[model samples]
Target: MRKDLHEANRLSWNAATRAHNSHKGDQAQFFRNGGSTLFPEELALLGEVHGLKALHLQCNAGQDTLSIARLGADITGVDISDVAIDFATQLAADAGIPARFERADVFDYLAHAAESSVDLVFSSYGTLCWLSDLNAWAQGIARVLKPGGRFVFIEFHPYAMVFDQDWTMCYDYFNTAPLAESGVSDYVAESGDGLAVGEYQAGEQDFVNPHASHEFTWGVGQVTTALSQAGLCVARLDEYPYANGWKGFDGMQDSGGRRMVPPTGMPRIPLMYSIVAQR
Candidate 1:
């Protein structure tokens, strides 16, 4: 199981690296237009971090890491993707942003980081599901945090993960079994154009590889329990019924620039959650 998890991490990080390098142009726009800023409503939930040492876990391409740096935090972004770390470092240097990025597995990185070195640990949307063991993940978070430090996360609601690709209800939300692979297009790459595969840059094709996609689902209660077991006090939790970013649902509309199930006009169930916890 440990070996399988490591291999899964390697695959995910490699895929993310290729995706970031190939889709840099679109991704930059995506972030600027609110991809990294997906939970704009929860920005204030992170509270103040000026001059604080912050670590960003699973920080693909460093958008959110740089975003935190812009707010005056001394930031270090760790990802399992060397490609992503290279691009992120270059991007930060080019933008004159003072931030550092490293390619390391989250668990390995946390294990080696000096205890109580970081004042804040931040992660966001779509990050936690990639992790196979919640307890180990939580322990790593606890190991790296300073006394009274905080860990903040914003992620896709597990309830949303239970829905089938057709956007109709399916599957057991509480089931812990690994899900079958969905050979669908990347959520961020798919817009109103309908399932565009392979990235495009300056009217030309960028990287294209089929072995680079994977997905997983995790329950909310399970995640909270892991955090508690790690000795973190849950500070605040908020669920939003709407998402301001791409949601993998057909017939979903980017209503007024925010993504939500539409036309049927149902008050969309909470699709995402943000949590703040203290060590």
Candidate 2:
């Protein structure tokens, strides 16, 4: 793993957690009020998860972890950010929901997991871009799963990620290069309000309020190939023309409170995708 890149991205997400958990416009309140963060697509794909042993990777703030637990699954949430994990732990306790949270790099945690011990390994939206290596990720998912265990993952489509927030083609669809940005704003802020909170340097230059994010793009083929090479059989692949929420987009009409798809006369695109793979 690229430790440098991981550390850089971790700092940004750690900072993001603060804003996300505190902002009134964010889902923290909903989660605290016993709302499920699990989207409809993932819930449908993960039908009947009751009484399963589940592992939620990159489970920021433990909202989804608690959601799954509410569905009768024994869940353990893992995240790289210590601050985030701390918050998740407290959130779970405050909500009187039984959950376990660990702070560690996902790769390291999976490396130490008991072989064939987990019944299901899950992750969701905006989870894939932070990692520099997808093969290792798939291998980790395979490593922790029991025979016939399932790996259910949902993520923003790589093709959709190629566009900027305005849906304009601004980035390379097939680019493998890592992207670095500074002075990042909180993505979940109802408006452009919250800002990054630390000092950072991108060389000899130093800046204040510097939140740094480093992300890598992986293609659809890359994702499927990695899962296949990791010994997991792809049981189902579903593509959706909508995202769970508006991603700072314009001209998108809300289908319901939970979904936003392209309006009429607009060319459709795959905004998100879900994969169900089994060991």
Candidate 3:
């Protein structure tokens, strides 16, 4: 069950949820204002979700979940962090969006779901990193999905994740080892404030959080192969040189307020990738 990994990450994310919900950014504002968190690329891949029964895995503060519900899908979101689920539930209610949120490890949640009951399984950026097993994850996606149901996912490319902030190769692309680190930053805002659960690292750090996290690296091929092995047909795969979300790269610039483009003179790299699969 990866209990230790789950516990560590849960604490980290619980801390992150607090900061994220209160941060005064477009993400926090948009969710509070009932705005959609989805970008154009995934939205186009989603096609028509009207009236579909969709399950959003690792759904953080329900911003994206509510966004999908606004598209007319019967949405249910699941996350490992109880704090995240609670905030998501409250956010949905405040947004007047009818949705459900459950705090459970995604694998366990999918295990108990009725077979072939869900029309769609969805997840987005920074999701797969928290997972230790892609094969089991894909199987879960296949388990709850109705026949011909779709799995839409987008994540930071492993190729891009291997590099550090300075674009130096600091990590392995195919490393299966659990990368553990303390004193990480909250992406939602620049300050941890009440969210810090551990001692913040001194000297020029990003968003500060005391909690530690465990992450695993999986390559693009591993993801596709796992989905295919789990009885899902790969329908589409796309890679983008720019990212829809921040990746903590130095000197990256925004592209038309939509994507974060790499700095000038830097060699092109795949910052993100997407996959659409059918059960």
Candidate 4:
């Protein structure tokens, strides 16, 4: 892993964390009222985790993590951003949910994580790009998972990643370079999906973080192959034409819930995907 680059991203996330929350109001109250941030796709794949030891990686703000806790699972969420972890911890307390939040880089946290300590590992939504080393990630996951435990991964597909926010082709599908984004605008409420949740009405704000973020675009093949080499058996891979919340182009319609889809007649490509791999 590129520690330097990863450090830079941590700073960026710290800054972005505040910006991400700035658009929202009363997050603690939302959790207290039994609100959730999880999409239906994860719910179906999650099955039953009641009383199972679980881990949520890169859990920002812990809204979804707390939701999982509602399912009666003992879960701890880990993230690299201090601000995010702090917010998550406080939210857990405010919501009266029993959970643990740790601030650590995923790789280092995984390195020191006890082998065979967890029954399930869950990670989702815009997580992989910030990770610099997938092999180490896979090995760490393989090491931590107990016998027969599976890792549930949900993410935006790399095929859809080639297009920018405007649906224009701006990146190479096979690109292996680190993307450095500086002075980026906030995405929480900009996608129009955030406001669609019908929870507390967010306040209007223009937010931007100047910190440079170092990210990578590891494709589907690279990820599955890494897990295979790390002794994890890939049990399932599912692709969806709809995306969760973040709409990348105009004319995107709501697919009956928080999911959004491309305009009516465009060629359908995978906007998101999920994988289930067992140790």
Candidate 5:
């Protein structure tokens, strides 16, 4: 991964971090009231994290990190955004959750991480797209996991990323270039997934971010192959017809609660996928 590319993304995430938090109004209070930002999909995948040393990569603001800590895991939340780590640190303190937050490039953190150290490596939602080198990411994951340790991951299907928000096929699934996007932080309009499943709704905030982002897309096959090459056995690969929390496409229907499914009459396709790789 080029340092300049990652640095640009880091700056962008730093600028957008506050906007993401604006949507989740008063998160410190939310956690203090015993609220969790996790969804059922990830919870089922991360079954029984108690007593495990868990690492959460790309943990923006640490909502899910604190949630996992509440589940009895000794967890560390990591992100590239400095503002995000600061906010997460304060949130953990305010919520009285025992956890650690570190601001570093995922690859850097993984490179320096003790080998065979963590019991679980977890990430979810829009994680893979931020990675510039899949091989390095996979190797890092394998290096940090204990023998028999699991890497539980759920991410937006690459197939779904080929389309624009208006249901137009605007991007190539196999595109290899770093996609450059300016003002990519559309935080105010975020919806479709939350702790109460949008029951405790907060009105959209007027938000703006000036930084740009650089992102990459890796196919499911490529991701699984990387993990295999890194000496991790792929234990499970599951595809879901619906996406949790993110409503990126137009005409998506709420399948009760946070699950967002394609509009009626649309052909079924994988919108999200999960993988369990054991080291």
Candidate 6:
């Protein structure tokens, strides 16, 4: 298991390293450019976090980490990508935000963190899919939380993964097969950069080899179950019909900076969910 995880981490790290390096210095810019604008609705659900001790798992390049710091949380961020961590550390230093960034697998970091050391465990979009084992992931979350500490997350709806292109749901909800998606740019790129249109780097193309990318079709039931199994009692679970980030769905419109299915209508399935669980 350790060997498998190590290999998986390597692949994910290598792929993410390039993206992290390219945008390392632009975290604040990204935020100011309407990054967290869409997120505030869901993020606001976390309530008052001023002065809280927060841990962000899979914190890529630390944009959200710094954003949370701006909210007054003493923050620590962990990611498998060394490049991401290095950039995050430098950004923190340059911005004068007192954030600690660490390079470590989430599981390893949680397993070894001093027990009950965090006031909150936070993760967001695109973070959980890389993890292969939810039970282990849950256990790690449980181990790190102090009594009454909270775990909050906002993730892409598993149902959104069913479609390869707009207007079709081609995949099974229950399938656990590792879907190898290649030849696409990193999801963060803007149009017309010239690398490959949607490709990651402008003027440069590279393949991202994700060692293990499995989407768990976790409905509300599964999400709550996993949190309960992890010993965190569910405090609140809220779902939104729209997403704060691009979800590759057709007919979805950007409203208040968030992507939403138009009122004229698409099926009202959730596009994102925020869960707050307490230890």
Off by over 4 Å in 4: 193-200
Which ten contiguous residues of candidate 5 have the minimum total lDDT? Answer: 192-201
Off by over 4 Å in 3: 25-34, 190-207
Candidate 1 lDDT score at position 96:
69
**lDDT accuracy of residue 85 in candidate 2:** 95
- Badly placed stretches (over 4 Å) of model 2 are 24-33, 190-209
Per-residue accuracy of model 1 over 1-279 as CA lDDT, tens digit each:
244655555665665455434434554445444344324554687678898999999898787788788778999999876677887898777666789999887878888999889889999877876676788888889888999999999887889876776777897887665554523234445442221212333222333444433455668888899999999999888897765565566667755545555336565687878889999
* Global Cα lDDT for candidate 6: 0.68
TM-score of 5: 0.94
* Per-model TM against the reference: 0.84, 0.89, 0.90, 0.95, 0.94, 0.82
Ranking by TM-score: 4, 5, 3, 2, 1, 6
For the record, the alpha-carbon RMSD of candidate 2 to the native fold, in angstroms, is 5.9
RMSD of each: 4.0, 5.9, 4.9, 1.6, 1.8, 4.4
lDDT of 3: 0.81
**Residue 138 of candidate 4: its Cα lDDT?**
94
Q: Of the candidates shown, which would achieve the greatest TM-score relative to the real structure?
A: 4
Please give the TM-score that candidate 6 achieves against the real structure: 0.82
Local error of candidate 3 at 94, Å?
0.8
Q: What is the C-alpha lDDT of each candidate?
A: 0.71, 0.78, 0.81, 0.86, 0.86, 0.68
Compute the lDDT of residue 240 as modeled in candidate 3: 92
List the lowest-lDDT window of 10 residues for candidate 4. 193-202
Instruction: Point out the worst 10-residue segment of candidate 2 by lDDT.
Output: 192-201
> Per-residue lDDT tens digits of candidate 5, residues 1-279?
877888888888887876666566667777778888788888999999999999999998788899999999999999998999999999899889999999999999999999999999999888888899999999999999999999999998999998988888999999899899885564335552332312434543555667888889899999999999999999999999998877778888888757888899989889999999899
lDDT of 3 by residue, 1-279 (tens): 486788789989887666655543434345555567678997998999999999999998787898899899999999999898988887777667899999999888988999999999999988998888788999989999999999999988889988888888899887968898773356534322211112222323345677998888899999999999999999999999988757367777766535777898887889999999999
